[model samples]
Target: MALIPVDAALERVLEGINPLPAEEIPLHDGMGRVLASPLHALRTQPPFNASAMDGYAVRASDTLDERRDLSVIGEAAAGARFPGSMGQGQAVRIFTGAPVPDGADAVLIQENAESVSDRTIRAAKPVEHGRHIRQAGMDFHAGDLLLEQGRRLDPGALTLAASSGHARLLVHRRPRVAVLATGNELVNPGETTGQDSIVASNSYGIAAIAKEEGAEIIDLGIASDNDQHLSSLFAKARDTAADILVTLGGASVGKHDLVRGALAEAGMELSFWKVAMRPGKPLISGRMGAMHVLGLPGNPVSSLVCAELFLRPLVAHMQGARHEPDMRSAALGAPLRANDERQDYIRAVVRHTAEGMIATPFTRQDSSQLTAYATANCLIIRKPHAPAANTGDDCRILMLHR
Candidate 1:
């Protein structure tokens, strides 16, 4: 197959993808979950006219006269209302959030009133009608649209939903991803290693990226090059009902690359094999039964770069969200040589300077150098067949960190 460009490959990876089914979960558990539908207020806020401050609920006309001392008929506190209405020359001692009594349209704040005698007080200052009162449904009314569909529940959103009388929320199900690492030369971390054996570190990074993108990760451990071992893990992924199965490494056509063969035999339809991008060209995009398959390169840096470009967007798309990477322009801090058919994602450190944003790429960009990838905060994108760029040339960059 011809090598697909990065943009084309990403488009193919996301084509035909729809949001996962919605599930009803408790409101408190909705943080970071996308709402599946428009959220409506179940009940009106401040269902009745309530006092906003500690004061006396009285007729507005009665407080206009400074000479008159109104008799305090009764007291009203939160969760309690004065049963009797206040007539002329009468006031109800009302606390904050207490319901305003009948025949009362204003609250004379305690600071604006003074006790003339027992059970009697005088308004020191006049209060207008509806002053210091929260009218019914002022904040929101029942059946009012509180949140739109596809809104992510943040702290503010969650609180707003709760205050709107929603004990449970309908949210898109968090995508469950099963991650499997495959290779014969790989060993579990902290285990005994031979001269040629390396630690299996890609799965942890993949899992972290997946989780940060709102996915539930299932670690399938490490799969050897053998077909039966790989098949068992694939079966586990199917049995677990994972929405996406991410296989690390064994995607290339090399002699020892066995994942593709086993997955093909197990009925995974291939979408694409290679992308025209540096470090992450041997990417496998496919589907097996009900699960999406992404075969990432084994090199740590390449694996993470691919995850950032592909996995994050896929996860967001599955949650009914639009994934737009943070792309910005920066001046090159040093000269760069180019002219290659494959697109390059040169890791670099971006700094804000008096001149402007400056991006200085690391010297060595080997696929196996995870340290450089970890240290860099941005990826300077170089288009295919681009010419050499001099220092201070404005270039586009994808920010890895906000």
Candidate 2:
């Protein structure tokens, strides 16, 4: 098969995909979850005219003069309303969030009033109508549309929903991803390693990405190159009912690279393989039943790059989120050479300069260099077959960090 372009490969990876079913969860657990349906206010906020400050609720006409004395008729505290209505030259001592007493059109702040006696107070300054009062439904009215579908419930959103009388919210279920690492030459971290063995580090990074993108992860540990062992791991993924199965290594066509063959044997209908992208060219994607499978390269940098480009978006999409890569324009901080057919994502350090953002690509871009990838804050994108450029030329980059 011909090498698929980067954009085309991403399109194929997301084709026919839809968000998972919605689930109702408590408001406390709704943060970062996407709304599955529009949120309508169940009850009006400030259901009644209420005080916005600790003051005396009086008729605007009663306190219009520079100096006026009014009888203190009643007191209204939060959650308690004064039963009697105010008469002419009458006022009610009110606290913040307290309901405005009947027949009171304004609140005279205590700062501008002086207590004349236990039952009377003198307004030292004129008061305007509706001053220091929150009108009924000021924040939101019952049945008003507060949050739209697909909105992520951040802190503010959760507070709004709660104040609108919502104890529960309908949100998209978190996507469950199963991660499997394959390599006979790999051993778990913290384990004593032989001279020829290296630690399996890719799965932990992949799992972190999945978690940050709102996916619950099931780590399937390590699977050797043996077909039976790979098959057992695939069975575990199926049993977990994972939305996506991510294989950390064994994607290339090498003799020991058995991930693709094992997934095929496990009944994955291959979508596409070998994208036209450097460092991640051997990426593999397919599906078996409802579970999607992605085979990433063994190299640490390549595995992480592929995960950033593909896995994050997939998980966000499954959660009914609107995911877009943070692509930005920058000036080249160094000279570059012409590119080949495969597109290049050069790891770079991005800094804000007086001119603009400057992206300086690392000197060595070997796929196995994890330290450089960890230190870089951005990926400078070079299109396939692009011409050479000098320092200070315009370029596009994908920001990896804030």
lDDT to native, each model:
0.93, 0.93
CA-RMSD of model 2: 1.9
Error of 2 at 290 (Å): 1.4
User: Positional deviation of 130 in candidate 1, in angstroms?
Assistant: 2.7
The candidate that achieves the highest TM-score relative to the unseen native structure = 2
lDDT (10s digit) by residue, model 2, range 81-164: 999898899999999999999899999999988999999898998889989999999999999999999898899999999999
Q: Candidate 2 regions off by >4 Å?
A: none
Candidate 1: worst-modelled 10 consecutive residues by lDDT:
333-342
lDDT of 1 by residue, 116-224 (tens): 9889999998889999999999999999999999887899999999998999999999999999999999999999999999999999999999898889998999999
Question: Which pairs of residues clash in candidate 1, taking residues 3 or more apart in a chain or in different chains?
Answer: none
